[model samples]
Target chain A: MKLATIRHGATTTAAVAVNGGYLPLPARNLSELLGTPEWKHLVRVATSSHSSPDVIPRTEATLLNPVPAPAKVICCGLNYADHILEMGRDLPEYPTLFAKFADTLTDPDAEITSEHSQSLDWEAELAVIVGTTLRDADEAEAAAAIAGYTVANDVSMRDWQSRTLQWFQGKAFDATTPLGPVMVTPDELDPEAGVQVICTLNGEEVQRGNTMTLVFSCARLLSYISTFTTLRPGDVVLTGTPGGVGMGMVPQRFLRDGDLLRTEIPGIGTLTNTVRIRTRATIQSV
Target chain B: MKLATIRHGATTTAAVAVNGGYLPLPARNLSELLGTPEWKHLVRVATSSHSSPDVIPRTEATLLNPVPAPAKVICCGLNYADHILEMGRDLPEYPTLFAKFADTLTDPDAEITSEHSQSLDWEAELAVIVGTTLRDADEAEAAAAIAGYTVANDVSMRDWQSRTLQWFQGKAFDATTPLGPVMVTPDELDPEAGVQVICTLNGEEVQRGNTMTLVFSCARLLSYISTFTTLRPGDVVLTGTPGGVGMGMVPQRFLRDGDLLRTEIPGIGTLTNTVRIRTRATIQSV
Candidate 1:
């Protein structure tokens, strides 16, 4: 089942993507939909009923990130062994975790602005969306709590990220990170079995890896994360990206003003974002 | 003017602390109050008229963290030179910033439970609350955006914190960090000039420093943070702590099951939380 959030003028609402069209759901957004206890049953009923009331063609409706304002956005760092070796670093024993606020999220097709940084890089990743609230969860509990999976590009600013020991400031630029086209249910998409995740620069393939290559599995990461903080229904865990970031390139290539970044996972979908460098006037005015 | 949030049964609401009493505001919480355009003026109107039809005395009203659910809780790491030196690190060129989710926050007088950690540590910090939204803001703009100042203890689980290179996991435990008794407006509290910040364990003065020693001032940090993400009302920045945490002490002291942790700033009120180690059942049950 594919669930998405589609924008309608001033408001965004959760909708079921069906046969190249969106059947608008009563819920405001995927975050709100997941918070409800009987979301699965509710979505099933909405999916089966013919009276969608307002079905928008997929191409016309603006698709946003499945979970626009998640309660928590926990990102994993150094989870890919290939990426680690490429960067000339040893594989870490534990998953290096970090945080990104909700404001950092942008639409799937939104323009990525290079305002504070010109050295923008792209990292293709598989994202896990939580369905149920879990705390101190075991492996089975973590597995049971899985709602679905999506695609994301952990767009990073190399300069600001390396300005200090922490990677948050650089990685957390507002509306810089592109997420989603839709979320595919876990029954339909199992990243553990090795799904191809790819990134392209202007239709040229740059990054390629299998989700099975992750150092930590989704269940293990979620269980570990739940040890400290409660994983809410709409919380998202971005499994770290594989190799082929701009930083690891031969000449350290970066995204130019008009560069297009396309992030894709076969079972999920694609996110195409155009990089736009903001001028001095536009920088301070935002 | 002082404002607070007080718990009534399971729900909490915004309040004004006046004349040693709490006047329940119409808004849901301090976050909601600050989100309004003219909160200061509205609060003033609520304060002077004496029509606090639902007033609760400060003693009887159970105060929660003033900002119960901020959109973002950005914690600055190693801001003070003394603490940075004590921790065997050089002064950083940029402020070390990390994040804590809203779940990590606990009430000022709530029991500070040591769930998975016996090596609980304390970091006394002055907190800045944002009142308006701003992006790429100047120092003057940053100064104007500050709504107030408060007290917080960045309680840390050292064992988990040092598990990886990043400190997020160890720092963000459910309801671990203590914040707020009340929020003092910036007109009353200026952390730049040097305000006394202290942390005591069972009445033993362990950590002591002044805000004057902070490498990054409030305005500077706000300005720096604005470069990437917009600072919205109800967002909080927990300025990094000063020296003398349990992690920095000789012989390495830690929190016991029944230790009293008190965090205080001169202008802002005190936060006294009793440390209680979570039982085996309580650990997995939450």
Candidate 2:
């Protein structure tokens, strides 16, 4: 099953993707919907009968970030072996972690703009959402708490990122990370078996890797994180991106004023966002 | 004026510290109070007429962490000039920043326990609270937006921190960081002129530094951060600690079970937290 937070006219709602439309759920967004303990049962009941009047046409709805108000949005760095090797680092015994607030997330098709950074880069990743609370969980228990998977582009500002030892300042620019076209349930998609995580820049393929090559799988990462912090329902954990980032190129590459960035996963859908780099002059005028 | 979230029996309320008691505000906590646009006006009106029946005696109230639900909890690393020099690094041109979640916070007098780490350490510092929304703000604007100042101990797990380049995981253990006894408004306690940030272990003093020596002032840090992220009312920013953390000691010290850790800022108040380290055996038994 595919789930989404969609905007229609003046309001947004948690909806289930139907044949050619969306069936509205009870809550305003997926974040609120997941907060309820019986969300799965509610989703089951809502989808049981999607009457003609209850379903909104797909063309009339605009998909938003599925879980926008997560208490935590954690990201793993150097999880992909190929990416680690490219950066000349040894495989890590523990995952390198960082954080971003809910404000950092943007709609699937929104424009990602930044004026403070000149080195804009891209990291296409598969994000996992938590279905249940987890603390000090083992790998098996972590797997059982899986809610679903979505697509995200970890858009970064390299200039600000390189200014300090921590990557948070650069990665946390408001509305930089584009998330969700739809969340695919774990029962339908298995990242462990394999799934291609792909990224394209202005129609040119830049990154392509399989989840099978991840140094830390989704469940393992969740278990490790829960050792110190609690993972509640609606929280997001982004699996690290694969190799072939622009930062690793011969001369390096950055997004221009109007570059189109697309991130996609086979089971999940694609996020189409246009990059808008505001120059200092443009900022001063505003 | 000193503001706090005081617990009376099972409920908590945002209150102002009056003569021998607290005058209750309209909101449940400081976080909620700060969210309203007319909070200052409300505080003014409430304090003007604090009848005996409306005031809760000081002895009857227990103080919890103020600003419990900040959307963002950003922290600075290596901000004090003396601390930076002690670590053999030059003053950074930009502040090194990281993040913590609301769950990382506990009451000022709460017990801080950890079962996953053995290298628990303490960092005493001043914490700044945002009073208004700020985006791309100048230093002057940022300064004017400060709601108040409080005390915090950035408790850390050195073992986990050293496992990766990022400091987030180590600093983000649930309920490890102790924040607040009370919030001292800008007019009352000024960090720029200098405020003594002191820390003691057991009964011996370990660290004492003045905020005047901060490499990045509170206003400067806020201004820099606002360039990339939007900081709203009730958000928190913890300035880095002074020179004498357990990790910076000659023999390298760590907290043990039943150790009393006290963090104090003269005009503000002190946080008395007992450190409880849970061994693997103790965890297994539970």
Candidate 3:
């Protein structure tokens, strides 16, 4: 089943996309819905009622992040062997983990702006969204913890990232992570299977990779990160992107104003964003 | 007035600390209270009703982070002149900003642990908690955005921090930031005035500094960070720590098992933590 959050009127409402439309769930957000045991019941009901007329039209609403304002968002670095090789860096002995605060999250179609440095880059990744809170989780437990999957564009500022040893400084600028059109639950798709993840600039494909190239599997990465910190319900794990980052290209390809970035993954749906460069006066005034 | 979050039964409740006791507020957490326009009214009521017998006593409660899962927790690097001098680095041309996920936050008396690295360190900093949602705020507006001040110990793992260019890997381990015994409102204390901030190891004073030595004042730091991201209600800014971090000492001092860290500021209350090192098997199994 595909789940999502949509802006109804004054506030956001939990939803489940069905047949070409969205059905509002009887919950506040994705976190609350997952916390209740009703998800399993809902899944059972959904299968049998697949042909029911309870579906709401999707054109009447605005989409939000599937799990807006999660407790944690863990991101991996250099997890793709081909990407690692392209950067002239050795394969990491252990998964390199980092974090993105909830505030950095935005809807897939949201606009991103960065004036501090104009060297913005795009990375298309398959994001795993956790369904249950799991700490010290084993592989099997990690698998059970996963609720669904989504697409994310890990937008970064190259200059700010290289300025310090920590990528977080450059990685966590406000509205940097564009997540979700909808969350595709594990029952609907096998997360371990490779999917064609692609990043397109305007109308042309610039990045093409598959989850099959990831050095660490979803379960292993989740378990590894849980050892360092707790993973709460609604938290997301962005498995690292494959080779075609704007920074790795010849002469470099940084994001500029009016550039549209569309990232898609099979079964997970598409994430679209537009780039807007901050003006000098706006930068200084801020 | 000072604010805090006390876990009562299953839910967390907001409270205002006064005299020798705490007065329970009608809000769930600091963020909720700040989001309401009645916050100033609530403060007035809390202050006037301090001596009223109707004020209930908080019983058997566990204190949570004063901010209670903020929108973001922005941290600065090398914002103190003395700290920059000690680290053999020049003063930053701009405030170096980084972030800590909400999961890294622990209560005042929580335990800090490390699994990947053994060389852990402690940094006592004056944390500014935003009272109002702010974007593109000027210095004056930034000062107005501040809700209160608290004591935070920004724990670090030296091995991960120094081994790479990005300090985030080491700076953001689980339970790395212990924030608050209570938040002292701006009306209660002047952050610019010299307020003795101290950190004691076991029972001996190992670090002593003053907010007066901060290279960028709270207003400037807040204003500078706003340029990068929107500062929302309950968002916290960890102004840089002064010199005397364990890493800056002769031969260097690092945290080990059974070590106790007690950090305090003049107006704000104290925070105590115990450090524990995780075993290899324990680390892997998690």
Candidate 4:
């Protein structure tokens, strides 16, 4: 079953996607819904409806990122073998971890506005959302903690990222990263068995790889992060992206005004976002 | 005027530090208080009068970290010149920023409980709390954005930190970083001119430096960070630490059970936290 956080007019809430329509769940957002002890059971009830109100036609509904203000948005770097080599780095013995805040999140269809850099780049990734609260969790416990999967484009500012040793400044511009079309449950996905993850800009395929090639799988990353901090419901983990970034291109095709970014994973869905360079007037007005 | 978040039993709220006792403020936390449009005016009134029912005595108050869950907790990697030299690194032109979550924060006087690594290290820093929202702020705007200053120990687990290319894993263990006793208003400080920052373990001075020697001043950091993200009320900016981390020591002294970590700034009060190693039995019970 596919779950999403959607809006109609001013009201936003979690819902189940079905038959080109939405079945509204009785929760404020995906995070709050996942926080309940009976979330799994609730989702079961949702799939088998008790006359769920057709909240809105899915086409007319405005979909928000599943977990907008997650407790944490942990990201891994250099996890994809080809991507690692493309960037001229070795397959790391350990995950190179970093973070992004809630302010950095933009909706699936939102426009990417660059106020800091002209070198905005894209990294398409298969993302994970945690469901249970676990600390010092072993591999099995970590596996049991899986809530679902989603899509994200880790839109980055190449100039800022490379300026300092730490990549945070370049990666965390407000409302820059796109994080969801919908969340597909783990039972519907075997990403570790090689699910295709692809990125395209202006109808040209730039990045293509399989999750099976991930140096560190989702379960291992979760268990490793849990060793240091508690992994709670609504926390997001962005598994690293594959190769073919614009930075690795010969002339370096950076994002410009009106560039289209499309990311797709077959079982989950597609995310289409247009890039718009904030004009001098538009920037000054804010 | 000094503002604090104090807990007595189950309840916690923003309060004014009066003579020997605290006066409860209308806001729930420092974040909410700072969010008000007339915060400066409100604080002016708070400092003057009203028969405020006596809250906890200042000395007896059970203070929590001033901002329990800020929108962001950004930490600097290397800002102090002398300390930067001690760490065997050249001066950086830009601030090396990283992140920590609310889960990693503990009360000022709380015990440092570690369930993971034994190579815990100390990094004493002067912390800034943002009061107003700003984006691409200039120097003057940055100065106005300052809410106040406080003390923090960016305690790290060196083993976990060095295991990976990124430093986040080791820096973000749950309940490790100590953030506040109270927030001292900017009107009371000359941070740019420098304020003495000292760190002592078991009453022996292990690290000492002045905020004046910071490679990036507080106002400059605020302005620089505002370029990428909005600086909201209660967001914390840890201005990095001076040199003298345990890793730089001759034999490398690491934190152990019963070790006392004390941090002090002349304008801000002192923070004393004791370290404890959680046993395996205690870890599993949770």
Give the best candidate by TM-score.
2
lDDT of 3 by residue, A1-286 (tens): 8888887768677778877787777677776777676675765566566664656578776888777767778788888888888888988766777778677788989998777768889989889988877877888899988888899999998876776555776777788889998888888877567778899999889888888778888888888777667787788899989889989999898998989999999787888899998755333422
Error of 4 at B85 (Å): 1.2
Give per-residue CA lDDT, model 4, range B112-172, as digits (tens): 9887677889999999999999888997999988999999999998877887667888899
- Per-residue error for A208 in candidate 3, Å, reads 1.3
lDDT of 3 by residue, B1-286 (tens): 8888878668787888766456778788786787786787897887786675644455556677877667788888887788889888987766777677677788999888776777788888999998887776789999988899999998987776654345665677777799998888898888788777789999989878888888788999888777667788888899988888889999988888889999999788789999888755342322
Q: Candidate 2 residues A111-172, lDDT tens each?
A: 99888777889999999999999999999999999899999998988877878899898799
Q: Compared with the true structure, what per-residue lDDT tens digits does model 2 show for residues B114-194?
A: 897888999998999999999999999999999999999999999888788998999999999999999999999989999
Best by DockQ: 2
Q: Give the DockQ-based CAPRI class for model 1.
A: medium
For each candidate, what's the DockQ? Answer: 0.56, 0.61, 0.41, 0.54
Q: Pick the candidate with the highest lDDT.
A: 2
User: Candidate 1: where are CA atoms >4 Å away?
Assistant: A8-11, A51-54, A279-286, B8-11, B51-55, B279-286
Candidate lDDT values, in order: 0.87, 0.93, 0.80, 0.86
Q: What order do you get sorting by TM-score, best first?
A: 2, 1, 4, 3
lDDT of 2: 0.93
| Per-residue lDDT of candidate 4, residues A38-95 (tens digit) | 9888877876864635547877788889888687999998899999998888888789
Off by over 4 Å in 2: A280-286, B280-286
Displacement of residue B28 (Cα, Å) in model 1 is 2.8
Model 3 Cα displacement at B1 (Å)? 3.1
State what share of the real interface contacts each candidate retains.
0.73, 0.80, 0.43, 0.75
Better of 1 and 3 by TM-score: 1
State the lDDT at A273 in candidate 2. 96
Chain B alone, candidate 4, TM-score of: 0.94
For model 2, which pairs clash? none
